[model samples]
Target: MDMWLHTANGQVNLRVSRQLYTVQSEYQTIEIFESPEYGRLLVLDGDVIFSRSDEFIYNEMVVHVPMAVHPHVKKVLIIGGGDGGVARELTAYADIEEIHIVEPDQVFVEACKTYFPETAQSFDDPRVQLIHRDGLRYLRGRQGEYDLIISDSTDPFGHTAGLFTKEFYGSCYRALREDGILVYQHGSPFFDEDETAFRSMHRKVYHSFPISRVYQAHIPTCPSGYWMFGFASKQYHPVTDCNPQRWQARNIKTWYYTTNLHRGAFMLPKYVEDLLKEAEAK
Candidate 1:
C-alpha cells in the first residue's frame, strides 16, 4: 500500500506520496518528484512562496512593478531566486537588455530544473545570466550597476536571515544606479510577530531610498494567507498613470493583479496601517 501525507485548509488539499512525488500548486498543477532531502514540495492554488513551480506570481510582481514604473530599465539583478522565475519575467520587457541572477544554492536550481521544468524554462532564455554565489557578496562587489534589483528570497530564516539585514539593504542601495528601483519580498504582515524587526527593516530601507512602501496580495500558501512586498526607488515614485495601451498589449491575465488593483493593494487595513505609522514614529 502507498502512504500519503496530507494537509488541508478549506477546499485546498496538499498531498505527498511515498513515491517521492508532490504537487507544487493547485491552479497550475505543478509537481515535483524527489527525496525528502530536497525539501517538501507543496502545491498551492496560485503560487507557493518558495517553491520553484510557483514562480509566476512571485516573478511577475517582483519584476513588473519596478520595470513598469521605470521608463528605461536596461540592467536588472535578481537575488536568491535560483528557480529563475524573476529572470523569466524580466526578459518579458524589450527594454531589459540584461538580467543577472545571483542565487547561492546550486542544488535548488538543479532540483528545480530536474523536477519543475515549467518554472525552470525561464533559465533557458539567452538574456539571463546566472551566478552561483551569496547575494550579499555579489552586491558588495558592484556599485551603481543595475537599473533594478529584485530580491526574491525565502523567509528571514537560517541562511536567509542576512538578506533582511540593514547592512544588506545598504549594499543594495550602493549597487543600484542613480534612478534604480529595489523590490523585495518582505513576507506576510499578517503572521509577522516581530514588530521591532519589521519596523527596523522598514526604517533601514527608508534610510536608503526616498520612496518606500509595502504592498499586499493574498497568497494561500503563505502564512495568514497574505504576502507583502516592499518597493523602494532612488528617484521615482511608484504611483503611475495607467497605460491602457501597455496593459492591452501585455494581455497578461492574472487572478490577483490588475490596473485598479494596483492602487487598492497599497491600502492596508486600518489597524495594520496604524501599526506601521506607530513603528515609523519610534
Candidate 2:
C-alpha cells in the first residue's frame, strides 16, 4: 500500500512495503511501518514525524547546531520528542548532566522503544529523565534551570498547536538560564498557509528572546523538502558566539552537522531571508 503525506506543493506517497504496528495513545495515533525507500516510518496523528532514512538530517541539525553554540550545556529540555531522537543526540556528550524529555503520550513512547530502538535506547541513560507530562505545563515555574530547551514537538497543529504559541515560548524563555538557547522546528516556508504560520511563530519568539535565528534542512518526507528551525537565545548569538573549537574538543561525532555547515545553515536563501525579514518587519 502507498501511504500519502501532505506537502507544500502536493503530497508525498511512501510505498509501504510492510505494516509493522499501530497503536492509539492517550493523545494521538502512532503507526510504525516499513517503506521501501524510507525504511522505518513513524507516523503520528496522520503526519510522518520521521523516516529512518532522513531522520539524521533533522535530528542532527536541531541538536548539534545549538549544542555547538552553547559550550557548557549541562542541562537540556526536549519538548514532545517522544520518538527519542533528540535525546539520543544529547546523550552523546559526556559533559551534559541532564536531559529531560516531557512527552504526554506513554503509549507512543513505548511503541518507540520497540520499533525505533536506535533512538529510544537514549531513554535508558541515567542522565535522561523522561517525564510523562505535558511539555508546556512542565516548564512552568522552572525558571532559569536549563541551559538549552529543545521544542521537539510535531508540526504546529492538533495537540502540538500550543507548542508554537506565545505563551508556550514565554514559558520556555523563562525556564532557560540567562545564557540559555531555545531551538524548535519552524515549519516550511514554501507554501502559503505554512509560510504564514512560520512567520507568525518566529515573530512570537522574537518578541520574547533577543537573538532569534532561523536555519534550514531538507527532509524529503516532510511537507516541504525545505524545512526550517528556530534558534533563539538570551545571550549567545548562534554565529558570532559559536564555539566550534570547544565543541570539537568534546568529540561528539555526528553524521550531518558540522561547524562549517553550522555556519552555512544560517546563511539563508534570499527568499528565506525575505521571509524572516517580513516576519521581523511586521
Candidate 3:
C-alpha cells in the first residue's frame, strides 16, 4: 500500500500509501486508487494533478488573498482548478456573487468529486458555475468580465503550458474589470532558477496594470517546500489597509494566512529581489 516517490531535484522523497474510495453523486466515478502521502496524486495520460488531501494551502492562498484585498470582489474566475479547493474558499466570502470554474478535463473534476469530497464540495455550492472547456479559449471570448481571476493551474507542463504564455496573460488582463485583480500560482521558486516564465508573465501583465508583485508560500508537496504567486491589479496592490479589529471579528481560524502573515509574505528575500530586478532590466 505504500510507495516511495522521488523529487525532481533528487534531494527529497516521500513515502505514499494507497487507499480506496468512491464518490456517489454528480459526475460519479468508481473506486480507483489514492495516494496516502499527499492524498490522491493522479497520473492521467502521464499528467499529474492532485486529487485529494492537504494541498489546500496553495489553493487557499491563491484564492483568499486577492479576495481579502479586494473586499468588493463580486465575481471570480478560477482556471484549471477542477479539484474545487479554490472554489471552496471562494464560497467563504458572502459578497461573492458568482464563481466561474473553467477546467478542461471533466474526468479530473469527476475523479475529485468522487474520491476527494472536501475538495469537490465547493462545486456543489450554488454560487459556483463550472465550465468544462479550455481556459485560454474561454478567456479569449470574454472581456471586462471578472472581478478577480485566479489561475489555479498545475505545473507549467503538458496541457498547462499555455497558462504561462504571454498571450494567456494578455487575455487574462482583458478579461478582468477595471479594478480587477489577477492572482496566479506561479510554480515553485526552488527548482525554477531562471524564472523566465514568471518574468515573462510579469512583464506582460505589467504592461496594462500599475501594480504587479510576487509572493511566496511554503507547501510540503511542492518542490523546495516553497511556491510563488503573482498578483497583477489595475487599481490595487496586494497590500492594503486592514482593520485589525474587523478581521478579528470574523472569528476564522486560519492555518497559514493572517494579517501579519499577509504583510510578511510580500517581503521577498534578497536573492529573489535581485533576480526580479535583473529580469526587469532585461
Candidate 4:
C-alpha cells in the first residue's frame, strides 16, 4: 500500500517495503516506514522526522556547524534528539568528554534503537548519558555546565511549543559556559506556518543571545526542501571566528557538511534575510 505523509507544504507518497514499527509514545505517535526512495523513514505525528537518504544533511548541519566554530567544545547537551542521530554525530568527537541527551519520549528512543540501529549506534557509547525528562526542566539548576547545547527538537507546536520560548532560550543561555554555542532547528521558511514560527522563534532567540544567526539546509523530505536552523552564541561568532582549517584537521569524514558550505549556508536569501530583519525590528 502507498502511504501518504502530510507535512506543511503538502503530502508525500511513500512506497512501504514494510512497516518496521509503530508506537504511541507518551508525547506523540511514532512510526517507521521503509521506502525505496527514502530508505528507512521516521514519522512523528504525521510529520517526516528523518529519512536515511537525506538524514545526514539535517544531522550534520545541526551538529558540525556549531562544533566547527567552537572546536574546544567538551560537555554537550542535546535537547529532544530521541532518534539518536545527533548523539551519534557528537560521539564521533573524542574531545567531547560527556554528552547528555534530554528526550521526553522513551518509545521513540526504543523504536530508533530497534529499527535504525546504525543511526542509534551512539546510544551504546559510554560517553552519552540519556535522560528521559523535559528539556526545559532539566536546564533549571544547570549553570555554566556545557560548552554547546543543541535543541534537536520537533516543530514548535503542542508539547514542543515551550521549547521555542524566550524563557527556554534564556535557560539555554544560562546552561552554557561563557563561550558556549547553541544550535536548533527552526523549521522551513518556505511555508507560511513555518515562517511565522521562525519569526517568533527568531525574535525570542535574538533577545536571548548576544550573537544570533539563521542558517539554511535543503532537506528534500521536509516541508519545503528549505529548512532553517538558529545559531546563538555568547562569545564565539559562528562565521567570523569559524576556522575551517582547524575543523578539517580533525579529519572527521562528513557526507554533507564542508567548510565552504558552512559559510555559504549562512548566506540567506533576500526574503529570509528580510524576515529575520523584521523579527529583529519588532
On residues 74-129, what C-alpha lDDT tens digit does candidate 1 reach at each position? 88888877777677666667667888889876666776787666667878888888
Pairs of residues clashing in candidate 2: none
- What is the model-wide C-alpha lDDT for candidate 3? 0.74
Model 2 misplacement above 4 A: 1-9
Q: Residue by residue across 204-252, what tens digits does model 4's lDDT show?
A: 9999999999999998888767789999999988899999989998889
Per-candidate TM vs. native?
0.81, 0.96, 0.86, 0.96
Candidate 2, 150-268: lDDT as tens digits? 99998777887888889999999999998999999998888776778888998899888999999988898887678899999999999999888988888887888889999999999
Q: Rate the local accuracy (lDDT) of all candidates.
A: 0.68, 0.88, 0.74, 0.89
Which pairs clash (backbone N, Cα, C closer than 3 Å) in model 3?
Answer: 23-114
Q: How would you order the candidates by TM-score, starting with the best?
A: 4, 2, 3, 1
Looking at model 1, which ten-residue stretch has the lowest summed lDDT?
26-35
